[model samples]
Target: MRKYLFIFKAELMSALQYVANILLHMITYFIVIIIFFYLWNYIYDDPTQLINGYSKTQMIWYVIITEIIWNIVSGRKLCRRICDDVKSGNIAYNMNKPYNYIGYILSSHLGEGIIKSLIYITFGIILGRVFLGAFPTLNVLSIVLVILSLILAVVIDTLFIIFIGLFSLYIEDANPLFWLYSKLILILGTMFPIEFFPEVIQKITTVSPIYVICYGPAKLFVDFNLNNALNIIAFQFIYLAVAFGLCGVLYAKGVKKLNVNGG
Candidate 1:
């Protein structure tokens, strides 16, 4: 446990050391916000008319929350680290360690996710306030429900990414899989609400974990209905369990098939 925490802290310190890199990322981040701002503004045409229960201000807040959740749940570092370790044959060291490799990876990933989400969410909220007058509408209980749903979203996303990363054990290049996963998330409402989808597609999306990851929580914040918020939380947990179960099986199989070369 202590070792995992140390590794997480070390990774965070390394990330912070590149101050210019962080600032560059922030710039790109703001560019995305601006692009979405104009895009949504154009889509609605009339900002006053509510579309699918979201006003322009609420829509901007939804984007902000979605961006934050997308960053946290995507596990970008985890995928890259797994690819690097596999390519460099450094994963052999992890295999020999007494600690569970999956758990160690998850903890480190969660640490990075926490830091990135905090930075982006804080910046986004401040930016939204300045430019869009966007703010969350949830009361105390709804806020609690949103938090729980977000945590479940993180768990489901982590499991899915871990499963995806395990493909490195079998394939020489997992980058394609990573790219496909990212594209799916982007297209499946991680960046926007599922309401943008056609009615048939939107119906399908209601059961997808991607919808729970961002859209559901964004809805909770924008609407603040207790019953619906509770339902979203429940659905998040259900998907979390399903994702984790599948990952457990995949991890077991992938570890057994791991080939450590030049060790």
Candidate 2:
């Protein structure tokens, strides 16, 4: 545990060193929020109007929360690093290390993301309030639940991405798979709420990773219903277990294959 914490600290410090680069990225994030702001504003010609059960404020805040969650956990480098390590045979060196490879990647990415997530959430709230002119109505308990859900969501996301990355042992490259996974999340989860889709599609998406990964936290924040919160939280835990198990299985198989290939 201490070893992982050390790795996390190292990665956090490394991210801080590149804070300037992250700030530049924030500019782009803000630009995106601005674009969505106008787009939503145009959609809600009347302030009292509701689209898919979301008022104009709720809808805009939904986008802000989803974007923040996406930026925070969208650790694309996890896949790239895994692919590179396998291609260069560098994973061989890490195989002898004390820490688990998947855990190391998760810790490092979480550490790297901490600073960026904080900055984005901070700016996201201000922008949402300034432009959208409202915030999610939340009490103490709901706020706690949302935070817990987000933490689990992050772990779930990391595990799935690691699973995809470990496929490099079979596919010889996993970028395309990551791209496809990302697109699915972006379109089904990030771009709009599940309610915006047809009834058939909505039911299917609720069972997908996107339900917990991108939609769960955002949905809870914007529309804090206790029943829905409990449901999303339940699914988040189930998906977390599934993702962790799949990652372990794939990684074990991939490592065995790597050894057999003598590479």
Candidate 3:
């Protein structure tokens, strides 16, 4: 645990050296938020109209929160790194390391993303204030719940990515799988709320990564129902356990296969 902390700290410190990159990412996020704000504004011609139980402000903020999660999780490229390691025979070396490779990957990825997520969140709040004139209608407790949910969401997302990356140990590449995953999240989770889709699609999404990874935290933030928050958080824990278990099984099998093949 201590060693992983040191690795995490090292990664965080190293990421600080690339502040310019993250700032560019911030600019991109801000531009996307601005576009969504205008689109929602145009759609809500009548102020009192609620589309799918979300006012224009709530809708835009939902996009903001979802985009933050999407960007933070997507930018890590965990699967690509794993693919590259396998291609370069580096996974063999990594397997022999003193630290758990998955732990190292998760810790370093979190360290890399934390600062960027913070910057994006700060700017996103400022944008919300400027354009929407207020934050989500929430007290400190609700905000805390949203924050906790977001943290768990990030973990679930990272675990999924790691699971996808581990596929490189079996196949030649995993980028295509990640590409499909990203598109699913983008369309089903980030671009709009699940309620915007057909009822059947909504039901499918609830059982998918779309529910826990992007929609759960964003929904809790923009809508803030205590019952919903508790339910989402519980589901997140279940998904986390499932994701971790699947990753462990796949990785163990992959390692065994690698050893047998003497790769």
Candidate 4:
């Protein structure tokens, strides 16, 4: 446990060195929300009018929260790192390490995400307020709930991306897989709330990772609801367990295969 904490601290320090890069990404993020602001404004002639149960303010805030979550997790980069590890035979070096690979990755990502989360989340709130007014209902309880949900969401997202990256052992490439996964989440819930979709699709997404990953925290932050908060957090925990289990199983199998093949 202490060793993992060391890894986390090391990564946190390393990430601090890249603060400038993160801020550069924030610039792009600002541009994105601006576009969304204008687009949503045009879609709704009345700012107060609700579409899919979200006023313009709520919708834009939801997107901002989602984008913040996406940028913090940065699943694509993690996936590529894992793929590179496998391709370069670097994973074999870790086989002799005392720490579990999955735990190491999770801890490292959490550390890396901490700084970005602070920056992006802070920027996201200001952007929402400046462009779309403040979050309709901001309270201490709501803030706590949203923070918890976001933590679970990012952990679950990192584990799942690790799972996908582990597939590099079997597939010739995993980037395409990550691309599809990211796109599906974006289309289903990140860019637009599930309510905007047809009932059938909404039901599917509500049960999918997007429910907890992209939609859960954003929804809770946008509109505070105790019932929804409990449900999303509960689902996030379940998904977290599932994702971690999958990574462990895949990592173990991939290692066994490599050993058998005389790597």
| C-alpha RMSD for every candidate | 2.3, 1.8, 2.0, 1.7
Q: Indicate the TM-score of model 4.
A: 0.96
- CA lDDT of every candidate: 0.76, 0.87, 0.87, 0.88
Model 3 scores worst on lDDT over the 10 consecutive residues at 254-263
Model 4 has an lDDT value of 0.88
Instruction: Give the CA lDDT, 0 to 100, for residue 207 in model 2.
Output: 90
* Candidate 1 C-alpha lDDT tens digits along 87-179: 788888987888777777877777666666667767877998898864666577777887777777776778777778878878866767978
The local lDDT score (0 to 100) that residue 253 gets in candidate 1 is 81
Candidate 4 residue 211 C-alpha distance from true site, Å: 0.3
Model 2, C-alpha of 64: deviation from truth (Å): 0.8
Candidate 2, 70: how far from true, in Å? 1.3
Query: 72-141 in candidate 4: lDDT tens per residue?
Result: 9898999998888777778777767999988888899889999999999889888877776565676888
State the lDDT at 170 in candidate 3. 89
Better of 1 and 4 by lDDT: 4
Instruction: Give per-residue CA lDDT, model 2, range 91-192, as digits (tens).
Output: 988888988988888888888988988888888899888887778889999999998888888778878988999999887899899999989888898879
